[model samples]
Target: MMEQNQSGRSLLKQMTLREKIGQMLLCGFHGTEASGDIERLLTEVPIGGVIYFARNVESPEQVERLSKGLQHIARGRGNLPLWISIDQEGGMVARITEGISLMPGQMAIAAAGSLEDAYEAARISGLELKSMGINMNFAPVLDINNNPANPVIGVRSFGEEPEAVAEFGVHTIRGLQDACLAATAKHFPGHGDTDIDSHLDLPVIAHGRERVERVELVPFRAAIAAGVDAMMSAHIYFPALEPQRLPVTLSPAVLSGLLRKELGYEGLIVTDCMEMDAIAVHYGTVEAAVMAVEAGADLVLISHTAKLQRESFGALVQAVESGRISEKRIDESVLRLLTYKAKRGLLRMDADEPAAVAGREKDNAMSLAAAAPEQAERVERGDRSHLDVARRISENSITLVRDEEGMLPLKLERTLVITVATEVTTIADEQLVQAPTLGSALADCGLEVVDLTVSPEDVASDSARLLQAAEAEGVKQIVVGTYNAVNPSGDPQRRLIGRLNRLGKPVAVVALRSPYDLLAIPDASVYVAAYESRPLAMQSIARALTGQIPFAGKLPVSLK
Candidate 1:
């Protein structure tokens, strides 16, 4: 088998530089079919593959055509075939939204505490990807989210523990690979600690090598053992790996030294989006591309950089001719790329029935649409006693974070207050509140809520003006939370939290969208996270606010 594989590698070496470079580039094709110049480019440039997003694909039938389009290009570009890929990792990142089983994300699988569920999710996604002509899935995020302050990968991770991500992620990779779709574990060595978003700006991991090995490398190690077809490097920089240099994507120390030599990852090493700020914002396209290849990358991903792709390909061919980048090195990656296509049966253009594909495509979209609503169900069916616990927590947890003057637990008849949000028409937005069923049972006996906007910088800047308007209506205890659902503290939430915190009026903050919102604002004298902002849950909050129910909800995870 090794001899046969070697022979296959030798054959791929005979291909042209253009053909070799084509196998290393992957692009996204929006809409169901690849058409016009894009289709022409696929055949002319013979780029490696396509990555699909939810908008580009509607049902499985569309994906079949999309895949066939790429395959058609491949068949036209001599004998080599294409590799269609997507981020169909289930849950939020799934691109196979057309006709497949829409399983819960890694979080749900982790919550279910079942490997079988994770495996089944992967298997179903793989079957669907295969049906659509997709041979690869950029999935099974191996980041072990250990930081609560992490802005991005929260529930997307399997769980907080490295072992859990490894355990559950392994099962998912195995299942996807078994279904004949190449599964990629990413963003390597990890992207779980930083609060920064790499999509916008580069994030730095200041951790030393020893510390990273202890925590961050856990999931990737397991992924390697699980036989994943590829490992995607992170955009994060590890100084310990390179001493003072490139992020993992362009760092030979991390890619060739650690991943290849130390961990022994023989499979493909695909870089995360080379167009991301970490790569593009810093280095010139030509320089970065050359450095990436020479730094030991087998497949470089340059999403959203067609011009860079052209420039980089031109540079690599020149490098080979000029003895700058050895052809032997290029051959190393080409052989792997070609063998992957062969193993994928891409060269054969399997041409599975279009009718069978059409049926599955419709099924996939319906399943994904059905699963989107499950995000809410997680809390609704979460704890049967959530209402009672919410009641208790809201009532008791309302301690003054900093009551320097001790103006708290407003005396029922003494303190006057009003609330505000979006639904209320204007500053004239005053309505005398009746005691809610639960509120009527508590100390103050009355709870009032008015509506306003917590979005855009302007609304946030005018927060004081808006809140003052409510205060002028003879009010106290400025209770604000309804804006939780709409803006949830991008600009609006932050503005609201800032105004309410500085109000010095015994303000209370209630956010029920993501628990992360609580950490964003100053410690509210009364902070309540209803988990979700459902009206029914808000009704429960009214009761809890008035001491009608005692606060009993324990912290799911620490707010800090």
Candidate 2:
């Protein structure tokens, strides 16, 4: 370890100022293929890493080729291996979903009440991401979802209880790291308990230091104790931590004083994207990038906008040249990055071939072997095993919130499954591709189903028409799926449920996204919480509704 540290420092010393500045940047581009602007950025700027979003992903083969191609570009530039990162947190936040294992979100995992399930789910996700050449995962959200109205981090969080979030989060960190994929415990100190999303506007956490430590910082402390590889700083402001009301991403008091000194965190401190509205709209992107590094962030991520990416890199270079930010401080972060890369076997300065330095010779051989017919068959068979784990987690996370009128296990031959179309709630959540609706899942379960899809705006405006539709003569039972009906926008969905209760048809309300929907539609005969609207959760909900499996999940958050 000591020799490795010295070697990393030696490599750090050999870096030019521009190369050192590039090491602090993690950028993103806009393409499925890497031949355009991304190629130029990698060659000219030599960014330390790249983040993959939904737009950059198409299929398993395309993703593998993209990741490998990006690393090859970095190698050609004589740079260390690039950190290929993705937000594969499963559920709605997953970027690569088609061929990879899609596990439940943190809330769903906590709802299942199994620490082993949490660990196993993360392990599966990590292994699959590693197979696709992704080295870092921005995942295992450490936020505690205590607020019911939080738009962005509802089901992304583990649970409301601090201790549960801490325990479950630690297990997930261990799983991802053990799989040889760097796990990032994120949106620190916490993005929960705020109604606003940092992607749009800055949210403030006004809690005192005591409450913040007790609730918000619980999981983060646990993650640090577990030796998590990285942490993504939140853009939310904490009045108790920083007096200036600046987002934590650019606050020296929070990032330097609180996280570095008080917490004694030695790993990388990565800022959430600098282009987010919390920073971009308020502080400007290039200015925030310099402040983030000055604030003790080891990496400043500027995902999207190559113009901003180039400008931020140049701005950091100027900050160092002007002596506003010391070269020693810059070297500190580069050394940390080098040390981490070396520890992960992603750096070997003594090697002549960059492929050997990146340990990609074996990966290249494996890629070739994967082209063989038998290897493809083996890969398909392995995917099944991972899918089963995902299915089990989804099944265990199906919470039967209520059945006061005993309307479960629908005995009716024909049922009306009314599903509200899910809107992209936040920038962090992907626009789901052919997300299975509750009606389709019910149809799969052998019900004579009449399916109706309504948007929240339409439901809010045309509740009577929806009610008339639900009152169709042959439909004996009504199953309505609500996506975050607790929001004021979902009043029409809540009203439609109330009107459906008057029809004498048994009403079973399924909370697809947020479990707190039951709080608004209290009179529904039955209520079930699926936590997410993803395909696996829909399948589990369908099975649980048909009595094929019992609802074994406990509520991870308070609905009352």
Candidate 3:
């Protein structure tokens, strides 16, 4: 340990301001394999890490070659091995594919009712990541989906409660570490309650310290207790913490005072992408980086811009010399960082690879998801899945919550239904669509469906009038299926279903998106969940509704 200490100091003394700055910015290298501009950037920019996006991948065999190439780039920066990282959260957010076993989203893993499942997935993910020459993964979203209307989180969160997320998040972290890739628990201080998308605009979590400590902070706290190597800050703002309305990424009160002083999280603290609108709209790139660092961010992520990295680095260097940012503080971060690198066993690896293989993705995701319980449940439930319950509370769950007496199933086969919603643009829309699309399927089933549409500005009036018209036509079943509205329309949808029920017609509610929407329109006599808003999912729901297929879907997540 004494000799190790000496070597650490020597290395730190030799690093230039550019080298230190390079260690902070995590650049993204596009291409199947690292080469050309990637090499130049590694040598000149001397970045500390590289984040892989879908554009950088092909097959898993190619991924190993890509990783080896990045190791080559790191040689120019004093032989410091670059942290090769990917967003491999599985289920929608995966980068490395082939050979590695893939699991469904966190909810599926949590639903598996076993921590071992989470560990196994993370272990295999880490093992594959390591084999491909990558060293880190941005995974295991720890945010509790306390709010079902949250579009960005959905299946990404382990579950709707804090305890479940904490249990699964810890297991996942252990698994990744077991595989040798440093696991990251992300969007620190929580991104669960916001109804605005940080990618498009700034969202504020108005809860004070008490609320944050009780719920949103649980998973992160558990992660810290487990000694996770790092945590990623969110781009969303928490007004209770800062009066300036600064995002957690730029809030010293959060990173320094709370996370460090209260939680004792001594590991690395990384900021989410600085290129995102949450930070960009508020501050220039330079100011953003400076603020992030001053606010206690150990690694400021320059996920997109090479130029912005330069500006941020220049600003930090200036701050150091001018006494605005102390070198001692910088040194503390650098030391912790160096320790992280050492812990990864980088000093032992040669960082050269012409023989690495990467068939992990193909083997992992497709095969594993196909064999998983979620697939089995999907097969069982057919189209009527995701009831926010453990079992098929099925026909019983289609409650007439507000109806004085049950309305009769409509008598007319010539039912007119028009769809008016589109894909969700952001993840924070309060209302989530639970039923699958019933348009073409409705037509194919020989129902004379009359479709209606509503604009964002005129949706309320439009939906109201459309229901009235359906009532006027003596329509049998007015299917209210909207899979694209990602806002909190729980009250409105319930109220609408109530009106349609009063018309004394059978109302079949289909959710093409999240099953959580079913909770809003409890009065619908028959409810079908397609489990997704994809066109295929929509088609599947219609088939299931008409009894073409028995609804075999089991609840993968609990909505309550």
Top candidate (lDDT): 2
Per-prediction TM-score, please? 0.69, 0.94, 0.71
TM-score of 1: 0.69
Per-residue alpha-carbon lDDT of model 2 for 446-539, expressed as tens digits?
9899988887778877776677777778888989999889997888888888888888888899998889888888787699998988888888
lDDT of 3 by residue, 433-468 (tens): 323336566677555676665433445666668777
For model 2 the local lDDT of residue 138 reads: 98
RMSD of each: 10.7, 4.1, 9.2
lDDT of 1 by residue, 326-380 (tens): 8788877777765665555543222231111112221111011111011111112
Per-residue error at 181 for model 1, in Å?
1.0
Lowest-lDDT window of 10 residues in candidate 2? 364-373
lDDT of 2: 0.85
Runs of candidate 3 exceeding 4 Å displacement: 1-7, 76-79, 96-100, 349-513, 519-560
Per-model lDDT: 0.61, 0.85, 0.64
